[model samples]
Target: MTGRRIVSIWFPRFAMDRWRKAHADTDDGLPVALASEAAHGTVIDAVSEAARKAGAKAGQKVTDARAIYPDLVVEASDPGGDANALMRLCKWARRWSPWTALDGADGLLLDSQGTAHLFGGEAAMLADMNNRLRRLGFASRIAIAPTIGGAWALAHFGDRSGIIIDDDALDGALAPLPIESLRINADTALLLRRLGLKTIGDLIDIPALSLARRFRKTPDATTNPLRRLEQARGRIEEVAEPLVPQTVYRAAQRVAEPVLHVQILAPILADLADDLCKALEDGGRGLRRVRFEAFRVDGHIAALHAETAAPVRTPDHICRLFAERLETLDAGFGFDAFALTAIWHDAMPARQKGLAEDEAEGLALPHLIDRLSVRIGVGKVRRAVAYASHIPERSVVWRPALEEQPGVAAMQAPRRERPIRLFDRPEPITVIYGTPEGPPKRFRWRRKLHDVIKVEGPERIAPEWWRERSSVRLRDYYKIEDEDGRRFWIYRNGLIDDGRGGPPDWFLHGLFA
Candidate 1:
């Protein structure tokens, strides 16, 4: 009812992925067409606007497109590249308005009410957008209107110079547009055309009951043309497709000129960090990880990344963290602008911090640990406490040094008592002669044979049958002392003289103090 404002953005060659493939080395001024390769024949998926002007249409076979122009280049559709390009456009469009939604695969919709004044005015904004896109080698069509639907209709079918900007001329502008401008599926458009309703105005004038009666055969068929027309005006709530999966916590400052020197970049970087910290403070949140993206003039980007141990919002702390990473930035050619983004962050929970005078040695220990980790590598300086499980392989586990150590009972809950320095894997030994239940008087380990001097009891231990009952074994372990006062823990394999195999295999498992 009041002054309505909208912007429709079109990516003309967005669907013609074949043109993209054929012109991979060069994507400019090429006649390109995309086709769906199937059993019947390859049908045109999409064609460039230039190719369309030369007589190309969807559903036409590949042979048909080539028949029109022998030099026509063709390729299969790449849905992924199209999707990625759409997302990048969405991110770049954030410069225009914060609220921008993907119009479809090849277009975007912007609610341009009071926000159009930001780029001088709606006309100037549209001109600026078109100019920038042209400079970047992309041909785009932009349309502004009183409603999203009207803008879409005008952008796709109106005069190439731009269209429908007057406040009071919305209906007159949209009146002549065809029904296909509503962006319905191909089947719906064909059915509407068959019923002698080729334009939106024709569908709007049709009686709802009569139209419903005529198309009652198909469930997906439109029954109420008038009601659908009202919905087409974007009056109802429409879910927007977001470009990014999550909301980004970011702050950036566009430089007046491309900065080539590090001195020029330092203050900007510090200022951006300060601004981001303020934003985090406003939301009562803190940052754990942050990345700085340096967008160059040539479309190449360099990124500097940093992480923090605790939730930090102070500008000084954040700036210091980025200091080391900033050295990694490569200012090839020149960087035009810098943008700071925080990836993994969390809210600053209510916690206690000791007063400056009463604070103990907390900062010192953390600083020491960080330095050690940087020098020795993060994974090397970790706390590892291996446990004693009935299964030898499950005996030991490694815990991160940063994590709090659990109670002794939690660590001691293993079913078996294992030696502190147990070899990673047990080694088999050749014993001259030994009973299955007794210790070996002499054994060969690593080809060196030693005779046993003192012998202890034969404690029996059985394998857990629940894991594999068929392959279970009973072992008789002995604590024995050799001739040179060298003590060893040895275990006899299988049952005591069951005659299941030859003489039992002796395994010198571990060494004693």
Candidate 2:
């Protein structure tokens, strides 16, 4: 009772014999069924004992199997249906124990230690499981023992039926089983038989040290397979992959009843959120996004996701964000359970609270950005970030407004002024009466003539000498005023000595006022 006990079930020819029958109305005792894609097409993947007796085996070419038994019936394997079937079987097996896994395509392992008595005695439990499977039209062989190895052997190669190994009968039950039943390949089995180590009992009688030395060429030689086999008989530990993850570090509360009304669900959701928030805050981590999965009684799962502007483990704030998505959940057939999980968490950093309203207001900017982004689409709202480039087009970049602002130490807010209306591209405005040597005094711009009343000195900005200037022009910008009381910022392109072979031109760049 102190040692681990496990059960392994093998469907000798699950996919093949799941539905195939030897006769139309009766069971075919002599006819063995196999499931394969190759009847007259490809090779077989599974074969029954009757088919094996008729010289048919797995991986035998369809033609070869037909040569042995022409009347053999084969069907293509449906892997998807097979998987769904296995999952359904796993669910049914859960009635036996909470721990069970689909061991590959055709087998299952159940850990039934403390849970066995719930179904009666060990013999009765084993019989009950096997009978339930049989009633479900599955020809299954189930084995229960103190070790996985023993159970596997009993299920696959004992008396053409299954065996149940309790502690009292461990040695006696495993005495007659073959060493090959330990799951050695065909080649290894033949090699062991050649070495006069055929049955498990035969291999057990040999001294471990001698067997390792005598069979130096075999795979089992290194560890003395017999000793390992014996050690596994009653003292081995059973590791079961639970159908659901163990609820240890994680906590969950499933609603047994479907809650269609939001009023009823709101409090329950809020409670769970509060619990998670407390757990997260205590751990010094903030919640980034929380998922609420609603499992409906109709077997469909609907999920709602809420992402925060900042890492926050506040239950009230989290619940408010999720409220937006509650309308989308149909609650069809009613929601049977509600599950919540948090992702993208970060440790909440220690910081001083802002005493002034404006200081707190700046901190809330990121949250305002998140709300704006949700309303106008994430792409439309963002902070205007200034860059170090002198080129106006490359002077700024847009970023997601919801992202946390860079630490104040890393960002020095630009001291220079920014234009209220910046055009996508600077428009070219023609100006007359301007020469390359000086700024435009009186110019005709936009088909209107303006007389210069006040003028400023030209600020010459020359293009780099080695850089290509095919699309760019060297300019001397000047602030000017017209007699009508309008101010204009104008620039004259191409100095007299400029290398580019073009006449100097005047263009009005921007209006000063």
RMSD of 1: 22.1
Q: Residue by residue across 1-513, what tens digits does model 2's lDDT show?
A: 326567888887777555453234644545444445634667777766677788878777868878778977665656677778788888789888888877768888888889988978777888988888887777988888787777778888778555777777876777788877776567667878888888888866654434545545565522346434644464323344567754321235677778786566677678878888777766777766678777788999888776666777656666766665677788877887777678567667544456543222234665565556655666787776654334444456666665543211112434543344444455566555654477665778667888888878576655543333575677776777899988776667767656665777776656655
> Which candidate achieves the best lDDT against the true structure?
1
User: Judged by TM-score, which candidate is best?
Assistant: 2
For residues 233-280, what per-residue lDDT tens digits would candidate 1 score against the true structure?
533323344454445679987777787765567778889988997788
Supply the TM-score for candidate 2: 0.43
TM-score of each model, in listed order: 0.42, 0.43
Candidate 2 Cα deviation (angstroms), residue 431: 99
- Each candidate: what lDDT? 0.68, 0.67
lDDT of 1 at 244: 48
